[model samples]
Target chain A: MNLLLLEDADFVAADRAILRDRRLHHLQEVHRAQAGDTLRVGRLDGAMGQGELLRLDAGEAELRLTLDRPPPAKLPLTLLLALPRPKMLRRVLQTVAAMGVPRLVLLNSYRVEKSFWQTPFLEPAAIREQLVLGLEQARDTRLPEVLIEPRFKPFVEDRLPALAAGSLGLLGHPGEHPPCPRAVEGPVTLAIGPEGGWIPYEVEKLAAAGLAPVQLGERILRVETAVTALLARLF
Target chain B: MNLLLLEDADFVAADRAILRDRRLHHLQEVHRAQAGDTLRVGRLDGAMGQGELLRLDAGEAELRLTLDRPPPAKLPLTLLLALPRPKMLRRVLQTVAAMGVPRLVLLNSYRVEKSFWQTPFLEPAAIREQLVLGLEQARDTRLPEVLIEPRFKPFVEDRLPALAAGSLGLLGHPGEHPPCPRAVEGPVTLAIGPEGGWIPYEVEKLAAAGLAPVQLGERILRVETAVTALLARLF
Candidate 1:
């Protein structure tokens, strides 16, 4: 973990926290941290700063916290992803959270197998676990909001236009379309398709909803890689 | 698999190929491919074309191949990366190949765990397996050349200069350095550091060899994410 993330439940006082969970294991093993060592830390949805290890034992480690600096700014993005397969879903969640996406809409596509929606990984707790891992990896605090849309048509036809209204609406499709824009200023609403990509009809629906198609060349990248690549290029 | 990759051994004749491996299982299971089905196929380090499934059985599947199109062009870049942990190494190898990176150098760094170099994942066959998966993912037909440098100083001081000569040499570091450049028309040589980043002395050595540092803002990304982000932005 790049940053030792502390939740409210771990706090004993405003400036003191006790960690006895996996964080403690990470401290003892991965970090090989000792008492009196200082660690970079951040509170969930709060500020980031330093923590001085006060007491260390097998049961728990207490640290005096001093959270001051604000978390890093999130991307001006509202990502719409065709829910990936369960195995890929977990990694994509972590990638999205780590890359600073402010919001995510896991929408269905015609190609998205119905079984994917039944995965345990989509559970809030499971999703939050992956996001927390991402926050720890990127040293950020706030979690990105995740919205699930099982019905593609309703979400695209009813809610998408409003969500995409003021943003630079884009569809990360593969075709003879214009290249994905670079270093775009202001907000973006980007929809990325499933493995086989968006069906022609779905692309038209998204286009009608304000998201124009954009390509990233011929090579097909995995969903996680595409997410990072697109976010990096856009921001 | 987006493209059915055929090795030389898979060929029974100049135009006919038989598959009795994972590819066969994929055809039967994932693709639900049957006799008379036509699928996208690519020859190893050769051409891409359509394969007409002539026969399908539990033991084997036969395809009549007609190869024509050239694979996607590789990136005009050589990536230098500090060897990541084994699990990440596999994924990064896949990422490098999928993104069309033509060459890669897995170099030693101060922060790189010595155990990383000892991983079986570093074996040529193991590496090739991952790269092949990447090529299959992207529908590409060529594998990237991988070079390993266990010694950091000599490789950086003696060899990097010649390798970086006439190219846009850049070090993907996190600091007050200028933002990484984009859309360059020429070749590039990029060096990305390990988890904790390159130590000061290593950075200076790399600088002397021609790679100046560049930043991707404040948020720290994982090694794989950083690779994709940097490649996407630069290209």
Candidate 2:
């Protein structure tokens, strides 16, 4: 873990926090940390700063905190992604959070298998676990909000237009379309499709919702790679 | 598999091929392909074209190949990456190939675990397996050249200078360096460090070898994500 993330419940006092879970294990094993060692730390949805280890034990570790710095700024984008397979969903969650996406909408596409929705990985706590890992990887504090949309049509037709109204709505599909824009000026609403990509009718629906189609050349990247590539290219 | 990759051994006649392996199973299970189905196919390190399924059975499938189109062009870049942990190595190999990197050097770094060098994933056949999967995913027909450099100092000081002579040699390090350049013309030689990053002395050695250090903001990304992000931003 790059930063020792602290939840409110971990606090023993205003300035002292105890870690007794996996963080304690990481500190003992991965870090080989000792008392008096200073480590980077952040409060969940709060500030980031340093913590000086006051005590270290097999059971728990106590730290004196001085959280001051704000977390890194999130991307000015709302990502609308086709829910990937269960295996891919976990990695994508981590990737999305690591990349500093502020909000995510996991919407269904025709190609998304119905069975994917039943995966335990989609559970709120499970999703939060992956997001925490991403935050730990990136040393950030705030968690990105994730919204699930099982019905594509209602969400796209009734709500998407308003959500995309002030942003540059772009669809990441492989086709005869303009290349994805680079270093975009403002907020973007980007919709990426499933493995086989958005069907023609779905593409048309998205277009009507203001997400114009764009391509990233001929080579088809896996969903995780594509997410990273597109975010990197865009901002 | 997006493209049915055919090796020379699979070819029967000048314009025909047979599949009895995982490809046949994939055709039967994933694609649910039948005789008379026209599928995209590519020759290993050769042309991409359409294959007309002539026969399909549990044991084998036969196809009539009509090879024509050239594979997607590779990037004008050579990547020098510190060897990641074995699990990440497999995914990074696929990402490297899928993103069209022409060459990759999996070099050792100070922070790289000694056990990482002993992974069976580093074996030629194992490496080739991942690369082939990448090519299949991206629908490309060529494999990237992967070189292993177990000793860091000697490789950087003795050989990297000449290797990086004409290209825009850049190092992906996190520090007070310039932001990574975008949309550059011509060839590039990029060196990405390991998880904890390159030590100071190693960074200096790489600098002397003609690579200038560049940063990708404050957020630390995993090795695989960093690779995708840097490649996408650069080219």
Candidate 3:
């Protein structure tokens, strides 16, 4: 954990917090932290600063916080991803949050297996757990909002156009299309497909919704890699 | 498996190949491939083409190969990465290959755990297995050349200088450095540090070897994500 993230419940006072959970384990084992050691810390959705370890023990560790700095700015992005397989979803969530995506939409595609929607990983608390890990990895405090869309057509046709209206809507598909733009000027609404990619009809539907198709060469990257690649290339 | 990768041992004749291993199971289970099916296939380190499934049984599957197209071109880059923890090493190997990095150097770093170098994943066969999976994912036919450097100073000071001589040598570090360059022409030599980042002395040694330090903003990304992000941005 790069930053010691403190939730409101962990606070005993405005400046004092107690860590009794995995964070304590991390501090004890991974960090091998001791009393008087200063650690980088942040409040969930709040400011980041330093915390001086006041007390260290097996049960819990006490810290005095001075959260002052704001979290890093999130990407000007609303990512629309075709829900990956359950195993991949967890990693993608962590990747998205770590990369500073402000909003993510896990939408349905023809190629997405129906069983994927049943995965426990999509549960709010489970999703939050992965996002928190990402936050800890990146040393950020803010959490990205995640939205689920089980119906592809309704989401694309009814809600997507308005949501994508002001953004540079893009579809990350491998094809005979223009390369994905570099260092884009403003907000982007990018849709990435499932393993086999979006079907031709679905691609047309997305295109009608203002997400023009773009290519990232011939090599087909895994969804997680593709997400990082597209975001990196775009911004 | 996007492309059915065929090794030399799989060949029964000049044009016919039999699959009885994991590939056969993959064809039966994942692809649900049947007799008379035409699948995208690639010969290891050779060509890519269509394979007509002549026979399909529980024990074995037979294919008639018609190799034609050349594999996708590799990037004009050589990547140097501090060896990651074993679990991540497998995924990073796959990512490195999938992204078309023709050469990779797994180098030692101050922050790298001593146990990381002892992983069975570092074994030649184990490494090749991951690389093959990457090639299959990306539909590429060639495996990336992976070199291990257990001694950091000698590799960087004596050998890296010559290896990176004509290329644009860059280091992916997080600090008060210029942003990583985008869309550069010709070859590049990139060095990415380990989890806690390169120590000051190691950075200086690398600098003397021609790799100037560059940053990727404030957010700290995992090594795998950083690799993808850097490659995507640079290329």
Which has the better TM-score: candidate 1, or candidate 3?
3
User: Top model by DockQ, which number?
Assistant: 3
lDDT of 2 by residue, B157-216 (tens): 998998898999999999899999999999999999999999999999999999999998
* Share of native interface contacts present in candidate 2: 0.89
Cα error, candidate 2, residue B204 (Å)? 0.6
TM-score of chain B as predicted in candidate 2: 0.99
Model 3 lDDT tens row, B108-157: 99999999999999999999999999999999999999999999999998
* lDDT (Cα, 0-100) at A54 in candidate 1: 99
Model 2 lDDT per residue over A123-188, tens place: 999999999999999999999999999999999999999999999999999989999999999999
Q: Provide interface RMSD per model, one decimal.
A: 0.6, 0.5, 0.5
Per-residue lDDT of model 1, residues A150-172, tens digit only: 99999999999999999999999
lDDT: worst 10-residue window of model 3 chain A: A1-10
Winner by lDDT between candidate 3 and candidate 2: 3
lDDT of model 3 at position A163: 94
Q: What does candidate 1's lDDT look like per residue over B1-235, in tens digits? A: 8899999999999889999999999999999999999999999999999999999999999999999899999999989999999999999999999999999999999999999999999999999999999999999999999999999999998999999999999999998999998877799999999999999999999999999899998888999999999999999
lDDT tens digits by residue: candidate 3, A12-81: 9999999999999999999999999999999999999999999999899999999989999999999999
lDDT of each: 0.96, 0.96, 0.97
